[model samples]
Target chain A: MSVRLAITALAIGLALVFPFIAPNDYYLSVMALVYVNALAALGLNLTAGYTGQLNLAHGGFVAIGAYTVGLLTVDYGTPFWIAFALSGVVAAGLGFFVGLLSLRLKGHYFAIFTLCVGSVITLLIEKWDSLTHGVVGVIGIPAPPGLGPIRFDTSIGQYYLVLAFLLLGLFVMRRIVDSLVGRTFVAIRNSEDLAEALGIDLMRNKILAFVISTFYAGVSGALYAGYVRFLGPDIAGVSRTFDLLSASVLGGLGTLTGPVVGTIIVAWLTQYLQFLQDYRMVVFGPLLILALILFPRGIVGSLELWAARRKAMAEPRAPQAAPLAGASENA
Target chain B: MVIFFQQVLNGLTVGSVYALVALGLTLVYGILHVPNFSHGALYMIGAYAAFFAVNSLGANYWLAMLAAAAVAAIMGVVSERLVFARLKDAPPMHDMIAAIALLLFFEAAVQAYWGAEFHRLAPPFPQIVRAFSLTAPAQRLLIIAAAFGLMLALHLFLNRTWIGSTIIATAQNRQGAALVGIDPAFVSTLTFAISGAIAGVAAVLFAPINLISPTMGDLVITKAFVIIILGGMGSVGGAILGGLIIGFAESFGAFYISTDYKDIIAFALLILILSLRPQGLFPQGAR
Candidate 1:
């Protein structure tokens, strides 16, 4: 408990000091984008990582969130805060429909269905030009109207704004992971049959996991729109879905910190390797394949395994004298 | 009436090609249980190969198609042996990610070699054909005939040949097939080769009608996926039916509904059918 608290404190402190530490607007903007992507990846981890659902419509949910904010603010002149909340709500509602689909389909079927849903979402965005402005995209999305004198028009302000949501998102995810609900999610992932045998309602839990994840994706999308000040169909493309998937898997699955760490590494690599823009995916594809084949557990997962292994080696003689070490050894 | 017939003709033509792709997908899914996301890229590669054969080698169209299929078959065998074979026992997600990786790698390779610009194959037989007051391009008929012919040949191969039966047994029960002395690795290699060859043929057929580009695989893959799901995984007849359904939906939806939502119709059908009949319309061993 003390260690977790210290880590949380350190994270908060670093995030608060990050904008000032960044060298320029470019660095700050990159950090903001990383936070945005991390939030979405965290949402994805809830379903794909924890509950054993492969959701290829994450970008679609993100799109729903972004477009909600874009349309509400641009067309109706609504406030950013209200639009943000509405974005999550609308996206959650859509996620419910998607959850219903997940009920029937399993494994690759569910994954493909989500891919189709994602394609349909992008197509709708392109065809519904009146609302989305078609391929022209919604430009000049208004920045958050500052609360009192604290203007968020600057990079530091936007960084802080995005960081606040990311931290809050992390806190919520952590709380969920610590709860019995999270245990049920893990139970479902490890073995649905066994979970069902234990009287867990598969449909309800699956839907809840999906909805919660989509909620996070939606909120992140709203934050993204506010930071970037634009929205487009690319937000819902298959590539974006793959990007989110890569981030989730690259960091570590089924861990709260995994998504954040993974997103940071992935975002950094993609941004810094701008020279490999054309061949980046060419490189990324093989790299991802190698990761899946070699380190299916991902960076954080490998670390966790290594830590566990080290602890086991250190305490082979201690046995059950230390309950925490003993329990993990059994696991 | 003429318009409806024309739409039907168009649907059948498109559906035939869809059937070929779906067959490849279904075969791989049936045996390997890997969704094989790279199948579309292989298809795209086949199209490019045929294009290269005609343009660079000055080969006839027929010879070009055979070359394309042969090239794709070899590539498939290599991929199965080097990458996919190692992933057989891993979690399904691992295979899926690897396949997506392969998809990206293949797409980039095609782009690097062929450039990003779209290429169109000139129709070898450019004459117009008419039947029952419905006129269409000869290329469309060629596509339909070729697709159906390939499918029939595949059906015979699977049902009649000794090796084909061995492939079916492996798909049904891997452990059982292994116990019965069927070499699982050999079956895997052969399955991939055949699947890749089918995709190659579809690509050759598709290239003349549609613009061929690296990114062309994206749309083709999604459509083939829908067909396999609608048809029922591992069901040959189901693939044909599903392809036809998609083809008709796309054609009629474009004409009757908004052209913008044609793709959506196929997806809507997929979701609806999957919800009501998860096993699909023509589940294997049932019909």
Candidate 2:
């Protein structure tokens, strides 16, 4: 097998074994939450980083995903397994609509338009007061039944479930990134005008990216709903969108680590900084400024640079041209 | 009829505040070509500065207002020097994200210092201004007057002042401005400082009608964004017009439509305009 394949399999292998090695329920919970966030971030990174689209409606899609699972399972008593899959499709549908609808608008228009979607969703959630528990939030949702009596509701069980979702998310993301579609996405990100000139259909690619990205978000939301068994209005908030955007950018947009690194760091930072409460945003202002100044490409992108440096030293005699970096794609 | 007029007047008060905030937002956008998301936070900072200045220093309201603007303007200068200056040549959107990050940091920092519990006026402004049968809150009228006065001053500055005209020249053509002996960096610093100061002044004007809080920036900024879009971005006239239209829509919509749905009106208007007239009511000379 190729070195890349070997690394990939090892990573997957670690995912399967890692839950069993957890230290405690808290750690497991944190890990599970991080994985779910990572999943969502990964999907968002595809659009924001690769397709060069900034989607502020991610949280809304996540809300749709979580709520879809909530309604389907609670109202109809559909099993978690089935509802989970359906929730993704539901989220993807909305994502697809956003992608196709806003495809023509560029930059601020797209961002603002998606923002409208999130705001409208929040409005609907508030207005529809009957279905959702409104501002009070929803509760009493049951845990998914065990895999043959495993009762994944336990801390360890959550780890496994989150692990499963993470694996699936990673696999799907990997496929999306490695496939021809991924190249097309990067091509579009690099230059839509150029890509279109090259005969690539812009609308179709954008719509597909939107759908796939939101599907992951929905799945993440569904998993979160299942875990927490409670949903609130804040799920669809502008701050929620900000959280997702920050995470995507934090881990190095367009790099694989964009999601994983961003999710873990933001989750940990937010959780630990909860005591800071209202003042948290103030500190974040300087940190974000610092992050851009220090590492414009983010943690993962910077890490890749370090690795490349190591590789350069290890192979001094090989006449080398540096591989293409993503700055050209940024504009 | 009084109640109807009251709400409309109330909205106008709020809309006037929005116009100031929108001016700050667009001035930066116009000159630097960077969407400064942190402008809203500057408004919040301005409020807090005034809040502290009044309570701790026992200053006059006007003095407090000037202090708040000065403090926020200083913060803007520091930010321009350290953060935005580095990003002057980066992609325009990168600067936007940086501004957003700065916005988040300030908000979180404020939250950490002061809990999320709402804060009312620190040093009270007079509540009543009886104008014949048209009874207006003294503070509300002040907000309207201050916003308009600032708008006039800003227009004059743009048209009359050497530096301000240079900044406008930069907006018209960065390359040409540089060719014609204008320093783009000086224009950027001026843009950011002016943007922050405008927002700071707006926050001082706003503190009377609205409670002061860190999260207070969010909804106000959304309205500002809407105004910027509607006003054919970068046009001061457009900002004022957009602000008034939204103020009335929100005012009348709240009365006629359900208040719950009122929030959607701006977003809906925004979407409609994008779909129908993407360039907006008064398109900038060359969008």
Candidate 3:
């Protein structure tokens, strides 16, 4: 626990000082984008990683959240904070209905169903031109309003604002994952039949997990609209969902820190490999397959496994003490 | 009335292609129980294969289609052996993710090789065909005829051939087939090859009517999924019927409603059907 805390402190410390050391506005902006993506990926992790429901419609929820904020602020002239909060609400509301309809589907059916749902969302956004601006997308989204004197017009200010939300998201996620409901989600993921046998209301709990996950996606999307000031139908594209999937899977699903680490690695790789251009997915696709085959546990999960194994090896002299070690490892 | 009949003709043409593609998807799903999301990539590759054969190799349309099927069959076998086969023991989610990755890889690879510009295949049967009050392109009629012909051949092969019986046996009971001395791996490979070939052939027949591009398979593949689900996951006959149903829906929906939202008809039907009867319109094993 102390080691984990120390690492967290060090990481946050680095994040705090990152803007100062970053090369330019581009890097700061990229980091801000990373935080937004991480928040979205974390939301995905709750349902996909821990709950075991592979949601292909996560990007759709993000789109919903983004559009919500975009329309409210741009069209309705709603305040940034109000629109931001409403983004999560609207996404969760949609997620609730989608979940009610889709949670009954198991495995591949569920995934395929969600994929269609996502396409429908994108289609609606694209064809509903009068409302969503069609393929041209929502533009000139207003900057987030300042708090007192802390103006957010600058990249640094926006970066900190996004970072604060990310922290809050992480804190909430930590609480959820550590709570009883989180355990129920894990239970459902492990075995729905077993969880049901234990008197868990499978539908209710699954919907809860899905709704919370979409809420994260929504807030993340709203943040994106604010920072980028541009919203397009492509934001809700299936590719975006795949991006989140890659982050969650590559970083290690079912792990709290995996999404952040995976998002950072993926986001940075994407930035650095811009020269590859169209060839990016050509490289990434195979890499993802290789990663899945080689390290199904993901980076963080594999590291934890390695550490646990090392600890066990070092204490092999005490055979009766193994259970205690295992318990602590779970903690 | 003529226009409605014309729309029906168009629907049948489109439905036949959907049936072909959905048939392939259903076969693989029946045998392996994996959705095979990369099946769309295979379709795209098939179109590209035929495009190269016609444009670069100077093959006729029929010959190009045969070449495409051959190429895609090999690709299907290779992907099954290289990617899906390796992850047989992992969770189903892994198979799906791997399929999605393969999809991304194939799409990007195609884009890299053949730029993103859309290419039009020369129509072999461009003449207009008129029957009574309805007039249509000979290519559309050919598409409908050729798709049905291919489907008939597939039906016969699955029903009459020993290898096809092995595929069916494996789909019904993998372990049982293995116990009966049938190699499940061979069945899997064969199923993938057949699926790939069907997708390839469908692409060749359909590509001339539409523009050929890397993402052309995107919408078709989703519609194929919708058909498979509507027809029931593993039922061959269900795929056929489901394909026709969706084809008619899109045809009428596009004409009656808005063309821009024609694609949504499939998805909307999918959600509605799944909500009402999650098991789909057909029972499993109704082949």
Candidate 4:
């Protein structure tokens, strides 16, 4: 626990100083994007990673959140903060609707249903020209409003604002994962039948996880809209959801730190490979396949397994029967 | 009345193609139990292969389709060997992720190679056909005829051939088939090859009617998912019926309702059907 705390502290410390050390405003903006993506991925992790409901519509929720904020601020002239709060509410409402309908589905059915839902969302955004500007996209979204002297017009200011939200999102995620509800989610993930046998309200719990997950995606999208100052139908594209999935899987799906680490790594890798242009995904696709093959548990999950194995090796010898029992239980 | 007939003709043309694509998806899903998202990419690749055959290799339409089927069959086998085969023991999501990765890789590679510009395959049957009050392009009629012909061939192949029976046996019960001395690995490879070939043929047949682009498979794949779900996953007959249902829905919906939301009809139907009957219109194990 201390080691984990130390690592967290060091990481947070680095994040705090990152803006100053970044090469330019571009890097700061990219970092802000990273933070925003991490927030969304964390949301995805709650339902998909811990809850074991592979949501292919997460990007749709993000799009909903972004559009909510974009429309409220740009069209309705609402304040950024109010629009942001409403974004979460609107997205969560849609999430509830989708969850109530689709949560009954198991495995691939749920994933495919959500994939269709995601496409529907994008289609609506694209075709609803009078409302969503169609394919023209929502433009000139204002930066998050500042409180008093904390102006957010500058990239640094915007970066700090996004960072703050990311921290808050992380803290909330930590609390949720450590709570009873979080355990219920993990229980569901492990075995729905077993969890139901234990008297868990499967539908209610699944919906709750999904709603919270979508809420996180919503807020993350609102932040993205504010940070990027542009919103398009492509924001809700299936590719975005895949990006979150990759990050979560690469870092460690069920772990809290996995999303952030994975998003950072992916975002940075994307930035570094910018020169490759269209070839980036060509390279990335195979890389993702190789990563899954090499470390099915993801980098963090594999590391944790390694650490556990090392500790088991160092421990005093136990009875042969005891080791066999432990192995079965773990499996 | 003529307009309705025209729409029916259009729907059947598109529906036949959907059935072809969905049939391939359902077969692979039966054996692998993974929603191979890359199926669409393979379809796109097949279209490009045919395009290349005609444009670069001077192959005729039929020869180009054969080339596409051959190329895509090899790709399907290679992908199964390299990616899906390795992740067989991993979580189901891993299969999905790998498929999605393959999709991204294929799309990007195609874009890089083909420059993302839309290409039109020359229509072999550009003549207009008129029946009673309804007039239709010969290509549309050909698409329906060819798609049904291919489907009929597939049905025979699945039922009459030894390897086809092995594929079915594996789909029905992997362990049971293994117990009966069938190799699951070989079935998987064979299923993938067949699936790829079906997708390839569908693409070649359909691409001439519509422009072919790197992303042409996106909508087709999504609709294919809807069909498989509506028809019941892994059910061959269900896929065909579901494809026709959706194809008709889109065609009729576009004519009667808003064209802007024609695509939404499939998704809307998906939500409604899943909510009412999550098991789909067909029972499981209807293969």
Candidate 5:
């Protein structure tokens, strides 16, 4: 706990000081993007990582959040906070709707269903041009109003704003994962039959995870709209979902800190690997494949794994590895 | 109602393409239990192969199609052997990630080599024919005819061949098939090859009408997935029905409704099916 607190302090310190270190707005915005995606990925980690439900519809939820905020603020003239809160709520509502329909389906079936949902969302955004402005997207979205004299219109302000939400999201995720609800998710992930036989309400728990994750994705999307100040149908595209999945998997599935680490690594690689230009994805593809195969747990996941192994070695006759063997089979 | 007939004809043309693609997806998923997201990339590769054969190598359409199928089949086998074979027992998500990886690699490779522009392959039989108050291009008729031929061949291959029976046995119960002296690994590789070839044929058939692009696979793959889910996962007959349903829905929906919402029809069909008959049109238990 002390180590975790110390790490958290260190992370906060770095984030607070990051703007000064960044050379320009481009880098600062990238940092902002990193935070936004990390928050969103944390949400995704809840479903895909912890709950063992592969939802490609996350990008769609993000889009819904962005569009909601965009529509609310741009057209209705609602305050940013209200819009933000509403966006998450709306996304969660839709998440519940999608989950209610899809959660009963097993494995790849659920995944495909989510994929269809994502595509439909994109299509709706595209076709419902009058509201979303079609491919033109919703642009010129106002920046969040400043708290008193502190204007959030600047890149540093946006960075801090994104960082604050990311921290909050991480905190909430930590709380949930450490609780009974999280255990239920893990139970479901490990085995539905076993979880069912144990009298766990599969439907309710799955829906909760879905709603919570979508809420996070929704908030992330709202943050994205605020940061980027433009919204488009492409935001919900499968490619973005692919990035999230790759990052989550790269960081490690089901680990609390995995998404953040994975996002940072993946975002940095994609952002900084401009020298390769179009060939970056060529490199990215194989890199992701290797990451999924070799370090399926991700950077933080692998680190925790190494630490556990070392501790196990020191303890000598510890039988902890036995249950994990079964858990990993589910993962 | 000539317009309705024309739309039906159009739907059938497009539906045949969907059926072909879905056939490949159903085969891979049925036998190997791999969703094989890269199947679309293979379909795209098939189109590109035929394009290369026709434009670059001076082959006719038929030869180009055969060449496309052969090339795609080889790639399918290689991909399975290298990437998918190791993931036989891994979680479904791993296979999904691997499929995405293959998709990314193939799309990038295709873009690197062919550039991102859409390439067209003119139909060999471009002449229009009028029959029963409906005028249609000969290429459209050819598509339907070819689909029927392929479907017929697949039915025969599955029903009348020893290897086909082995494939079925493996799909039914891998351990049982192995206990009965059938090789699961060989079946997996064979399934991949056959699936790839079918995708190649679909791509070749559709190339004249839709043109070819690296990103085309993404859309078609998504639609094929919808078809698979609608028809019921791992059922060949379900795939055919699902494909035709999608084709007709898109045709009728686009005509009656808005063109923009045509894609939404598939999603609606999927959701409706999940709500009404979550087991799909042809449940695996029935087989």
Candidate 6:
């Protein structure tokens, strides 16, 4: 546990030092974007990867958080810290209720319901003109105060702020995976029927995943709103959902570092391929086709498998970790 | 009272489109056993196909619809053969990821061609209906009628036709159906085509009432998912009933419960149903 804690602290310290090393605004900005996206993707990985549920509603939760900040900060002139914390709580609450639904559904049924919640949330954000300002979007979010009254108005300042959040989020997520409840989550994800029979309450554990994931998403959305200073319904659109889903898939679902690495590559590809402009996502079809064709385990899953093999060969493995143990034999 | 009646009628109109969309979802789920997230993208493609038919091909509205259905069916068969066929034996998650990719691809395709803007779309149908009150736009009426008619046709086709029955038989039990001389390959392909055709017809009917856009199908697709879930995974009648129920919910919800949260009605109901009956509203055994 101390080893994990030290490694995480080192990672966060390194992340804080990163933008200083970049020496350029463009690189710094892109790095910041990756950090924020990875944080959100990490949250998604908990639900989609650990629980074997794809909640497309992640984008919506982010939107909820972002808009909360956008509305409170921009419309009503609330400060950044208070607004950000509020957004996180709101997202978590919504997630808990959404998770309550997940208790009954398995696989695609959960995906379907989450997709519905996400879309409806978007539509409401778009149509609730009195509050959200309709499709015109919430704009003019203020920057946070920095060291000695300085503000994170610059891209680099914002970049570091995002990095701090991202690293903290990653550490928290890793801790979750290490905890007893985390074990229960993995168990339930493997087989709800079995997990439930073993006294792991279905409604409580799954909702915890939902709430945690939603909290990450909301915080990310708040970061996005503050950084870009504009928030719209399309941020909760299927395309965004697809991007996050693919990021997790491409990075290797369920791996701690997988989402961070995958998001960096995919996010960069999205921008890099933006030069191709119109046909960018059109190629995404073939890319996904290729990914599925070649690496169905995903890049991370394949890497994990390779790592396991190497570890096995090196040690002759005392006892291998059980596969899908939580949901084990219940199905 | 008239307003209430009007809301009911409107809800039914939109709900039928959802029904049609759910039918596509249910058909593929019955045969292939995966939720087709890309079905929404395909639904959008159907609208775009119709857009191309009328705008570029100079076909009449009616003919353009048929062309759209034909083209959509072709796309479905191509997808089943090209991607889904390969994914048949893969884990269900793999299939879902693949569908999401297709969704991203098709949506991007529409964005590239049409740009991200919405089109008012001059649907071929004329606007006026003879009755002043208690009347729907002719295009909406066509949607409702066509939805019911298509459903009827499907029901009859499945019951009466050899091939349709073969598909249903395969759905019941693939191994047993094969044992009875029904080729699973043929049934799967046929089911995919019919599902695509259903979506195609739905798009044409919906184009006039709603703006036709590349991203148009997603909202309806989510609702379609709810309908399919409420109706039961593979039950055709369930899809129809589920769609209609959602329609009434949305219509009345919009009027009574704030239009901003009308869609929440369907989702709230989805959670309610799942907690009560995880198998769906019209489970196979229940029916």
Ranking by TM-score: 4, 3, 5, 1, 2, 6
Where model 6 places Cα greater than 4 Å from the true spot, the runs are: A1-23, A147-151, A316-331, B1-9, B120-138, B252-265, B268-279, B285-287
Q: Please provide TM-scores, in order, for all candidate models, with all chains considered together.
A: 0.95, 0.92, 0.97, 0.98, 0.96, 0.90
Which residue pairs does candidate 1 place in steric collision? none
Ranking by DockQ: 4, 3, 5, 1, 6, 2
Q: Provide the lDDT at B153 for model 5.
A: 94
lDDT (Cα atoms) of all candidates against the true structure: 0.87, 0.80, 0.91, 0.92, 0.88, 0.81
Best by DockQ, which number?
Answer: 4
Give the count of colliding residue pairs in each prediction: 0, 20, 0, 0, 2, 3
Q: Which pairs of residues have clashing backbones in candidate 6?
A: A187-A326, A190-A327, A191-A327
Cα displacement (angstroms), candidate 4, residue A185, comes to 0.7
- Each model's RMSD to truth, in Å? 2.4, 2.9, 2.1, 1.5, 2.1, 3.7
Please report the candidate that would top TM-score against the real structure.
4
iRMSD per model? 1.5, 2.2, 0.8, 0.8, 1.4, 1.9
lDDT of 6: 0.81
Error of 1 at B106 (Å): 2.1
The TM-score of the first chain in every model comes to 0.93, 0.89, 0.95, 0.96, 0.94, 0.89
Tens digits of per-residue lDDT, candidate 5, A206-306, equal: 99999999999999999999888899899998878888888888888899988888888887887778876766778888888777677767788788878
Between candidates 3 and 5, the TM-score winner: 3
Residue-level lDDT of model 2, residues A1-331, one tens digit each, is: 2755887788678766766776656767887888877888888888888888887788899898998888778877888889888989999987876676676677765776686778788877767778876787777666777878777878778878887888778777888898999999999988888999999998899888999899889999999888888888788887776777777777888887577878788778877888766566665657766777778788878777777666665765543333322342333
Model 1, runs deviating above 4 Å = A1-12, A316-331, B283-287
Give the fraction of true interface contacts kept by model 3: 0.72
| lDDT tens per residue, model 6, B266-287 | 8888878887887887778222
Name the docking class for model 2. Answer: medium
